[model samples]
Target chain A: MKATREAYGETLVELGREHPEIVVLDADLSSSTMTSKFAKEFPERFFNFGIAEANMMGAAAGLARSGKVPFASTFAVFASGRAYDQVRQSIAYPGFNVKIAASHGGLTVGPDGASHQALEDVALMRVIPGMTVIVPADAEETRQVVRWAAAHDGPVYIRLGRSPVPDVFPQGAKIQPGKASVVKDAKGRGFGEMRPEGERDGLDADVAILANGIMVSKCLEAWEILTAEGIKSVVVDVAFVKPLDEKTLIELAERCGAFVTAEEHSVIGGLGGAVTEFLSENRPCPVVRVGVRDRFGQSGTPEELLVEYGLTPGHVAEAARKAVRLKWAV
Target chain B: MCREVRKNVLIMIGTAGSGHPGGSLSCVEIISTLYFGVMRVKPEDPNWPDRDRFVLSKGHAAPTLYAVLAEKGFFSKDLLPTLRKFGSPLQGHPDAKKTPGVEVSTGSLGQGLSMAVGMALAGKLDRKTYRVWALLGDGECQEGQVWEAAMAASHYKLDNLAAFIDFNGLQIDGRVEEIMNPSPLADKWRAFGWRVLEVDGHDVEALLEAASYASESLGAPTAIIARTVKGKGVSFMEGQREWHGKAPKGEELSRALQEVAKS
Candidate 1:
C-alpha cells in the first residue's frame, strides 16, 4: 500500500522529464504535497511560494498565460478555500492551463483536525463554472490522474489523500477523464460487456456502492460483507466528481436502482452529493450517503477517525442495506 | 494623446451613466505612456508569443484601458459606450478572454502584480526578452496579497517586470490616509527589494524616463510610484473623492469633455 500523495510526487518527476513547459509551485507544503520530489529533479522549474497560497494561485495563472503548464500544490483546505477568489478570477475565469493538485484532502488528513481538512473543497471547486474536480482513489489511479491533469488544457483540481490506501486498480490500468471504472460487478460474475441503454432484464446487483478517495477500499470491503450475506452488489470508483461519470451512473442506476455513495469527505457536496444531484434529476433512484455528516474533524489516527465518523466497512454495509430497503419501499 | 485618451474616458463613463472616472483619470498618462511609447505590442496579433504584456490591476478603471486600447487600434472606439452592458465584451472589470490586448483579468485588487511576477518569471525561464507591465491603484495596496506578490517578485529577481501605482491619495471611502493608509509607498517598495522611482504621473516625459530606467535596471523588479490627482485634467472633478465612482451626467459631461479637450 502507498499513499496517493506519494504517487503524485513520483508521477510529477516523470512528467517533468517528459514536458519541459511544466512548472511546479507550492505554498510551503512541498514536503507534504510531494512536489518536493519534482523540485529535487527540476530545481529551476520548481517554485516555493513560502506559505502564500493566494499569490501562488495568481502566479500559476500568470505562468499558464505565458505558455507554461503550472501545477500549484498545497493542502486542499488552503488551495480551495484560502485562495478561492484567486482561483475563480485568475484561473477559472480566464480558463488558464493551470492544474491545482491539492494534497491531504478530507478527514484522512488525520491529526491535523478540521482546520486543515478540506470538507467543503469539492463543493467550492464544483460551483465554479468551468472548473474540473477529481479525487483519486489510490496510488495507481493517482499516477494516471496526475498524467491526465498535466495534459488537460484547462483548470483542473486534483484532491489527493494523506493516508496510504490499498491498490484499487492494477498497475497498468488507465483512467479516463469524467469516467468511472467498475472494479467489481454483480454476483462475483462481472459483466464482460455493458449496455449503454437501461436494459435491466438480466441485471443481477441489488445495489451499487459508488465511492472515491480512501473510501473506495472501505466500500470494497463492504462489498465482501454484502456478498457473504447472500447480497449482490457492484463497486465503482468515481474519481472525477464534477463532470461525474453520468453515462456510467445512468447505466448503473438502470440496473440496480439503489446506491450507497461514500467518500472521506463531508456528506454535503462531495461524491455523495454529486451522485444524488445527478441521479435525482436523471434517474431518480434511492441513494444513502456514507460520510462525515456536517461536523468538524478532531485529532486522531486515520483508523480511529474513520470508525468514529462512521466511514468504515460496517457503516458502508449498513448504508447499502438501508438503500436496498428504501428501493423496495419505493 | 493623453488629452485624447482622457476625453474618451470621460465620454465612455459619461455615456455608461454609472462608472468610475476619478481613478480612471488618475492613471491616464501612465497607461498612455506605455501603450504609445513603451511596450512592444502588435495590435493585429493580440496573442503574439513574444509581445510585451500589460495588465490593468485596478480593473474599475477599465474605461481608461478600453479607451487606450481602442486608441492603440486594439479594438474600435465605437464599443466604448457599451461599458457594463448585458451583451457587451466590455465587462464592468477587465476580462482577458473577451477582450483583446488584456493579458490578465483583474478587478479584485492586489492580485494583478502577482500575475505580472509570474509572467516575468516565465520570460526569465525561457530566456525571453519581452517585459510585463502592470498598473495598480494606491488604494489597492491595502490588500495583503500585494505584499505577498511583492516579496515573490524580488525573491525571484524579476528584472523584466515593472509596476506603476497611481497614487491619487483618495479611495472610495475618502482620502487613503484615513482609509487604512498604505503610504510611505517608495520606502515600502524599496524595503521589499524593488528599484524604486518616484515621478509626476501627469508628465508624459517623466513617466517615459522611469519606464526607460526600469528596462535598464539589473536584478530586482521596478516600482514606479506616480503621484497623481484623483480626478485630473477636468476642472470640476479634480481631486474630488465624489467622482471616484459617480459618472458625469448632462452638462457635467460636456464641461468635463470641454476641459479635457482644452487641456
Candidate 2:
C-alpha cells in the first residue's frame, strides 16, 4: 500500500530532474503534501509559499504564463476553498499551464474532519471553462497522471489522498487521459476476465460499477461479492472527471442495463453527478450513487469514516444490487 | 503622453458606451510613465525574455493600460476604439493572451500582486535582471489575498518587483475609507515589510523617479502609494463618486475631452 501523495512527490522529483522549467510551490504544507521531497532535491526550483495558498495559486499562474511549468501543491481544502478566486481568475480564466496537485482529498483526511476534506473540489474545478480535474485511484495511477498533467499545457487540478490505498495497477502502467480503465471485467467470464468486443456488444450485464479515487478498490471488492452472488458485473476506474470517457461509458451503458457510481467524494457533483448527466442524456440507465450524501463529515479514523459514510465494499455491493433491481423493476 | 493616454481613455470608454472612466482617468500618469519611460519593454516583442513585466491588477482600468500600450506602439491605436467590443482584442479586462504587452490577466482584485511576485521569483531563479510591476487600486487592497501576496513577496525577498496602489480615495460605493476602510494604509504595508513610497500620482516626473528607485531597491518589494484624484484632468467629474463607473455622455464627453485636451 502507498499514498498517492507520496507518488506525487516521487513523480515531481523525477520530473524535476528531466524538466528544468518545472517549478514547485507549496503553501507551508510541504511535509504533509510531500512536496518537501522535491524541495529537498531541487532547492532552487522549489518555493516555500509560507501558508499563502492564494499567492501560491496566482504565482503558479504567473510562472506558467512566463514560460515556466509550475506545480503548486497544498491541502485539498486550502487549494480549492481558500484560493478558489485565484484559481478561477489567474489560472482557469486565462487557461494557464499550471498543475495543482492537491493532497488530503475526501473523507479519508480522517481526524481532520470535513474542514480539511474537499468534497466539492471536482465539481468546483470541472465547472470552470478550461480546467481538467483528475482524481487518481492509487499510487501507480497518481504517478502516471502527474507526468501527464506536467506534459499537458493547460490548467489541471489533481486530487490526491493522505492515507495509503492498495495498488490497482502494475509497474509503469500508462494512464490514458479521458479514458476509463477496466480494472476487473466480470461481464461473462468469472473474476479478472474481460468479455470480447463482440460478446460485449450483446451483453446486458447484471450491473456496471463506475468508480474513481480510492473507492475504485472498494468497487473491485464489491464486484467480487456480487459475482459470488451469481451476478455478472463490470468495474471501471475513471481518473479524469472532465473530458469524461464517453466512448467507454457508452459501451458500459450498452453492456449493463443498470449503473452504480462509487466515489470517496460527495454524491453531489462528483463521479456520480458526471455519470448521471451523461447517461440521462444518452443511455438513460438507472444509476445508484454510492458516496457521502448531502452532508459534512466528522472526525474519525479513516477506516471507520469509510464505513460510516457508506463507502465500504458492503455499501458498494448494496448500491449495485439496488441499481440492478430498480432497472428490472422498471 | 499622459494627456494622450487620457484622451484615449475618454474615447475608449466613451466609444464602448459603458466603462469605469473615473478610475481609468485617475491612473493615467502612473500607466503613462511606466509604459513610456519607466519599464524596460520592447513594444514589438511582448514576450521578450529579459524584458520588464507590467501587470494591471486593477483591471477595470484597462483603458489606461490599453491606451499606454498603444501609445508605446505595442499594438495599433486602431484597436483602442474596439474596447469591450465583440471579437475585439481589447477586452473589458486586461487579458495577457489577447493583448500584446499585458504581462498577466488581472481583473479580480488582489491577484495581480501575487502574479508579479511569481514573475519576480522566476526571474531570481533564472538569474534575470528584468523587473516586474503590478498596478493595484486603493480599494483592491481590501482583498485578503493582497496581504497574502504581500507576505509572500517580502518572505521571498523579491526586490525585483514593484507595486503601485492608485490611491484615488474613492470606489464604486463611496469613499474607500467609509466602505470597508483599510486605514493606516502606509503603516500597514510597511508592517507587511514593503518599502513604501508616497507620491503624487498625477506628477509624471515624481512617479518616474519613485518607480526608478523601486527598481533598484534591494531585498524587499516596493509599494508606491500614489495619491490621485478620481476623474483627474476634468472639472465636473473630479472627486465625484457618481462618476466612479459612469462614462461621459455626448455633451459630457465633449466637455471632458476639451478640458483634458487643454492639459
Candidate 3:
C-alpha cells in the first residue's frame, strides 16, 4: 500500500529527469506533500516558497506563462482555500499550464483535523473555468494522472490524500483523460478480467458504485458486500471530476438506473455533486451520495475518522441498497 | 510621447464612461518609461520568447497599459474605444489571454508581483537576459500576497526583476493613509530584502535612470517607490479621492484632454 502523494513525489522526479521544462514549487510543506523528494533530486528545478501558498500559486502561473510546466504542491486546504484567488486569477483565468498537486485531501488527512482537511477542494477547482480536476484512486493511477498532467497544456488540480491506500489499478494501466475506469463489471469481473466493450454493453447491474480517491477500494469492498446479498454491482472509478466521464456515466445510468457516488470528500461538490449535477441535466437518475455530510473533520486515526464520517464500506453498501430502492420507487 | 500617452489614457477612460482614471493617470510616466525607454519588447511579436515582460499588477490602471501598448503598436489604436465593453479584448481588468502584449492576467491586487517573480525565475532557469517589470499601486501593498511575493523574489535573488509602486496616496474610499496605511514604503521593501529606490513617479528621465540601475543589480530585486499624485495631469482631479474610480464627463473630458495635451 502506498499513498497517492508518494506516487506524486516519485513521478515528479521522473518527470523532472525527462522534461527540463518541468519545475516544482512547494510552500514549506514540501516534506509533508512529498515534493521534497523532487527537491532533493533536482535542487535547481525545485523552489520552496516557505509557507506562502498564494505566492507559490502565482509564481507557478508565471513559470507556466514563461513556457515551463510548473507543479505547485501544498496541503489541499492551503492550495484550494488559502490561495484560491491566486489559483483563480493567475492560473485558471489565464488557463496557464500549471499543475496544482494538492496533498492531504479529505477526512483521512489524520490528526490535523478540520482546519487541514479539504472537503470542498474539488468543488472550488471544478467550478473554475478551464480547470481540470482529478482525484486518482491509488498509486498507479496517480502515476498515470501525473504523467498525463505534465503532457497536457492547461491548468489542472490533482487532489491527493495523506494515508496509504490499497492499489486498485493494475500496473501498465493507462489513464484516458475525461474517462472513468470500470474496476468491476456487472458479472463481478474485476478490472483485470473485464470483458471488452461490446460484450459488457449487454450486462445490466443493480447499482453503479461510482467512486474516486481512497474510497474506490472501499467501493470494491462494498461491491463484495452487495454481491453476497445477491445484488449485481458495477464499480467505477471516476478519476476526472471536472471533465467528468459523461459517456461512461450515461451508459452506467442506462444500465443500472441507479448510482451510489462514493468519495472521501464532501457530498456537496466532490464526485457526488459532479455526478448528480451532470445526471440531473442529462440522464436524471437516482444517486445516493456517501461522504462527509457537511461536517468538519476531527483529530483521529484514519480508520476512526472514516467511521466517524460514515465513509466505511458498510456505509457505501447501505447507500447502494438505498439507491436501488430509490430507483425502484422512481 | 508622454503627452500622447496621457491624452490616450484620458480618451479611453473618458470613452469607457467607467474606469479608474486617477490611478491610470498616476502610473502613466512609469508605464511610458518602461515601454518606451527601458524594456526590450517586440510589439509585433507579443509572444517573442526572449522579449522582456511587463505585468500591470495594479490592473485597475489598465487604461494606461492599453494606451501605451496601442501607442507602441502592439495592437491597433482602434481597439482603445472598446475598453470595458462587452466582447472587447480590453476587459475591466487586465486579461493576458484577451489582450495582446499583456504578460499575465492581473487585477485582484498584490498577485502580479508573484507572477513577475515567477517570470524572473524562469528567465534565470533558461539563462535568458530578459528582465521582468511589474507596476503596482501603493494601495495594493496592503494585501499580504504582495509581501509574500516580495519575500520570495528576494529569497530567489531575482536581480532580473524590478517593481514600481505607483505611490498614489488615494484609493476608492478615502486617503490611503486614513484607510489602511502602507507607509514607510521604501523601508518596508528593504526589510523584505529588496533594494529600494525612491523617485518622483511622474519624472520620465528619473524613472528611466532608476530602471537602468535596477537592471544592473546583481543579487536582489529592486523596488522603486514612485511618489505620485492620484490624478496627476488634470487640475480638478489631481489628488482627488473621488476621481479614483470615476471617469470624466463631456466638459470634464475636454478640460482633462487640454490639460494632458499641454507640454
Best by TM-score: 3
Quality of model 2 by C-alpha lDDT:
0.89
Over A1-330, each residue of candidate 2 has an lDDT whose tens digit, in order, gives 999999999999999999999999998899999999999999999998887789899999889877899999998888888999999999988889999999999999999888988888888887888889899998889999999999998999999999999988777665576788887776534223445546653245688888989999998889889989988788888889887999988988877889999988889998899999999999898999998898798899999999898999999999988998999898
* Superposition error at A309 for model 1 (Å): 1.2
**Distance from true position, residue B103, model 2, in Å?**
2.0
lDDT accuracy of residue A327 in candidate 3:
93
Q: Which of 1 and 3 is ahead in lDDT?
A: 3
Model 3's alpha-carbon lDDT is: 0.93
lDDT of each: 0.91, 0.89, 0.93
Q: Each prediction's TM-score against the native?
A: 0.97, 0.97, 0.99
Candidate 2 residues B1-263, lDDT tens each?
88888988999999999999889999999988887888789888889999999989999999999999999999999999999999999999988779899878888888999999889988998899999999999999999889999998898899999999999999999999999898889999899999999999999899989998898858999999999999999899899989988888899999999999998
Clashing pairs in model 2, backbone N/Cα/C closer than 3 A: none
TM-score of chain B of 1: 0.98
Model 1, A1-330: lDDT tens digits are 999999999999999999999999999999999999999999999999998999999999999999999999999999999999999999999999999999989888889888988888998998898889999988988999889998889999999999899988878765565788776777453223444446444345899999999999898899899999877888888999988888989988988989999998899988899999999889999999999999988888889899999999999999999999999999
The local lDDT score (0 to 100) that residue A265 gets in candidate 1 is 86
Interface Cα RMSD, each model: 0.5, 0.9, 0.5
At residue B163, give the lDDT of candidate 1: 94
lDDT of 3 by residue, B1-263 (tens): 87888898888888989999999989999998899998889998999999999999999999999999999999999999999999999998999999999989998998999999999999999999999999999889999999999999999999999999999898888988889988888899999999989999999889999999899967999999999988888999899999989989999999999987785
lDDT tens string, model 1, B121-170? 99999999999999999999999999999999999999999999999999
Who wins the DockQ comparison?
3
